[model samples]
Target: MKLQTQVPLNKATNQIDYSSQLVVLGSCFANNIGDKLAYYKFRALQNPFGILFHPLAIENLISRAIQQKQYTEEEVFFLNERWQCYDAHSDLSSVRKEELLGSLNSGLLETKLWIAKASHVFITLGTAWTYQLKESGKEVANCHKVPQMVFKKQLLSIDRIVQGLKDMLHLIQAVNTKVKIVLTVSPVRHLKDGFVENQQSKAHLISAVHQIIKTGNATYFPSYELMMDELRDYRFYGNDLVHPNDLAVNYIWEKFKTVWISETSYKTMDEVAAIQKGLDHRPFSQESEKHKEFLKTLGNKITNLQKEYPFMKF
Candidate 1:
């Protein structure tokens, strides 16, 4: 008998191989998958702007990037002695104003170029709730620790979410008509929104995503279902019981590889994984002959792989 009810996933028609260029953007779960691709030495650019939680925020960023819009000085403000842009994550906030501006502008250009050439763009939606700045009536990606009074919290309707995703798809296809989009809802629970509210938020996201998927402009991955169903135990969760632990992430990633990644690239991926594991190995006897031999072997492996794929970096 089957121990777990597995989500039935078909192999993607547009499979990702080592040659494919990828751009992953959206929630923190995007980071998890992006890092895995990076670890496997795939050419991937992930969340250049930062970790955006909601679909509208993600759409806003993608729209701006496609338009090559520059972030002006007026768009950012000094808060707690640091310069912050409401459109970006707190990690992009900087102590120096010029540094923040340069970074934002550079990131926009990079992201625009990446999307235009990317074979696959993975977008993970985290929630349907968003915060709008009351003064400008603009939806902000991150509040940046601003006082709660300055922002109005709102739950986006399914219609609005669907429209935003469609807009994002249009914007992307306008630049790169053939790009394949893989959309997934993040499994990380936002219990801070209250359990019931969190469920409502996820429901809105799930509904909107499925609508978009039906358009054939994108494909849907059952990441949320995988976590909620197959790995339903608390052991799969982090200490907060919100985010998936490392093991859970790995499990989901393995499932993703089977469906989304090209079968022909499996051997290459294994080779890459071996090289990565070797690089990560810590030797207790750095001066020993055995350790020196291991280093030589590792160097040879890197050299051989780099010969085949010149773009790879350790």
Candidate 2:
């Protein structure tokens, strides 16, 4: 008898192989999946401007990138000895103003280039809650630890989220018509918003995503459902009990692989995994003949894989 309920998933029509170029965006969970893809040496560009959580923030970045908008000094502010842009994550903040502007503008260009040729774009929506800067009357991707009183916190309405997502789809499709957009709600709980409030935030995201996917312009992956149902236990959570632990991430990734990754790539993936494990192996004796032989074998594996996929680097 089945003890746990599983979220049923169907294989995607356009599966991802090594040849596919991917762009992964939105939320820290996006990084979890993106990191997995990267570890396996797939061609993936992830969160160029950094981890953005809400739909409106994501839309703002995509809109600017597609338009080739440049960030100016007036757009960035100095705070706590670091320059910051409300439109991007704190990870992009820099000690120098010019450095911050340069990074932001370059990120826009990189995003445009990747999105234009990406075979698959995975967008993971983290929350519907957003903070609007009172001075500019605009939503900010990250607050960068600015005084809480300066911003107004708001929960984006389902209608507003739907419109933002639609705008994103329109913007991306304008550049690359054949790109397949896959949307998923991040399973990481935003408990800092309060438990009930977090549920409300997730609800709004889920509703808006479903509304958009019904049009067949995109597809939804049940990542949130998988975490909540299939791996519904505290053991699957990190110490904070908010984010999925490595095991949970791996479990979700396996499910994702089954549905989204091409079966033909499996043998190659296994070979890559073996090489990765070999690379990570630490020999007890550094100068031993056995260790030397192991290193030689590892080097040959890397060379062979690189010959096949020149883009792959150890």
Candidate 3:
């Protein structure tokens, strides 16, 4: 007897293959999928501006990237000995002001180019709760550890979320009309926002995503539903009980593979998996003849795979 109900997933019409260019953006869950794609050696550019948790932050970055807008000194501020931009995650913050601006501009350029050639763009929204700068009245992507008193926290309305998503779609489509956009709500719980508030945030995101997909402008993947339904237990979460643990991520990834990955790519994925396993193998005796032979074989495998896809690096 089946113990749990599965989340119904339809096989995608435009499945991802080795030739497809992919752009993965948004929440840390996007990184989980992106990591899988990277392991299987797919052409994917993930979170060029780092992990953006909400739709408006994503929309802001995409808009600026499409316009090729450069970050200037005026947009960055010194905080805790590092220069930070309100528009990007702390991952892009730098010790030097000039370096931060350079990295921001470089990320924008990279994102612009990647979106232009992407065959599929995956966006995962994490929350509807955002913090607006008290002085500027601008919603900041990350607070960069700025004092809580300096920012006003608020929940975005469903209508505002929907409009932001639409704006993102318009901007992306303007640059790459044929690119398939896939949207998903992250399974990670924003418990810091309080349990009830977290639920409301996710509800807003889910509602807005469905509204967008109904117009046939994008596809929706029920990642959050899968976690909440099929894997309905605290064991699926990490030690913090906030993020999905590795087991949960792998489970969702297998589900994602069946629906979105092209069958033709399976053989190559297996080959890559073998190579990856070999690379991760730790020999007891490095000087042993057997280990030398194993290393040689691994090198040959890498060389052969690189011959087919020059972009892959060990």
Which 10 residues in a row give candidate 2 its minimum summed lDDT?
A: 131-140
Residue 70 accuracy (lDDT) in model 2: 90
Q: Per model, how many backbone clashes are there?
A: 0, 0, 0
Q: On residues 1-314, what C-alpha lDDT tens digit does candidate 3 reach at each position?
A: 99999888889999999999999999999999999999999999999889999999999999999999888899999988889999999999899999999999999999999999999999999999999988989999998888999999999999999999999999999999999999999999999999999999999999999999999999998899999999999998899988999999999999999999999999999999999999899999999999999999999999998999898889
Give the per-residue lDDT digits (tens) of candidate 1, residues 121-152.
99999999999989889999999899999999
Candidate 1: where are CA atoms >4 Å away? none
Give the winner by lDDT: 1 or 2.
Answer: 2
How well does candidate 2 score on lDDT at residue 54?
A: 94
Report lDDT per candidate. Answer: 0.94, 0.95, 0.95
C-alpha root-mean-square deviation, candidate 2:
0.8
Instruction: Give the TM-score comparing model 2 with the true structure, all chains together.
Output: 0.98
Off by over 4 Å in 2: none
lDDT per residue, candidate 2, 1-314, as tens digits?
A: 98999898999999999999999999999999999999999999999989999998899889999999899888999998999999999999899998999999999999999999999999999999999989879899999899999999999999999999999999999999999999999999999999999999999999999999999999999999999999989999999999999999999999999999999999999999999999889989999999999999999999998999999989
